[model samples]
Target: MPLTRRSLMDAAAARFGWRRAYGDTTTVDELLTEQSEAAYTEAADHAALATAKNTDALAVQPGVLDTRGRILADVLSLEGVLAGARSRSLPSEVVKRLEDVVDHGHEVTVLLAAAAVRAAAAHTSSGN
Candidate 1:
């Protein structure tokens, strides 16, 4: 089957931790403009869409191959964004979406990494 949203979510759940979504919420775009200081500046800002992009791009955390560390990166990245957004009072909806995306992204990343790890493990264990 193709990699649908359901596949992604399932993979994420199996590799990382489970995921849950809250009620409808605003998105990061709603809170900050593309040209806003937060969005443009290199500095870490919740209002900055760049920060969110970076978080998404970075995606996987170090040692995500290790089951124990699967969710750490996702949690930290999400927390950082949330902290920034909350401190700046970005809209509640923006905050909610940010949290949701981060959490889901974390799951996806960890799942992808875990699959790599499993492949490597199999290769090593099989001695070829």
Candidate 2:
């Protein structure tokens, strides 16, 4: 289950003995908010946690591949457009080679994206 702010606050109070006195709870809300913000800030600054989250997010979002692929495809498309606009100056062989490379790059990206999806599925299934 996903962690919630209330759960985090409860855990913090339990783990850190941060509870207030029975009748001195006037600032409890402010104190809890401060504690939660501090905890979140600390967690966010942890490099290993940040990296793990990023890896997991990337694994689950295969569209990341499309984002990069789209950039490459657009660049290639631009090359084609430029070639057409200056067909007299550009060599046909260069354009052909560019197209070939773009096609091969796309095939490779698809394979890698598939592999990433499989790895992410395996990771989730294993409860890691």
Return the top candidate by lDDT: 2
Encode model 2's per-residue lDDT on 22-83: one tens digit a residue.
33554566666777988888967765654666666445455556555775677677667656
After superposition, candidate 1 runs with Cα above 4 Å error: 1-78
- Model 2 spans with C-alpha error above 4 angstroms: 1-89
The residue pairs in collision within model 2 are none
Candidate 1, lDDT over the whole model: 0.61
Evaluate model 2: give its lDDT: 0.64
* TM-score top scorer: 1
- Residues 73-125 of candidate 1: C-alpha lDDT, one tens digit per residue: 65776789799998999999989998888777777766767766676666567
User: How badly does each model clash, as a count of residue pairs?
Assistant: 2, 0
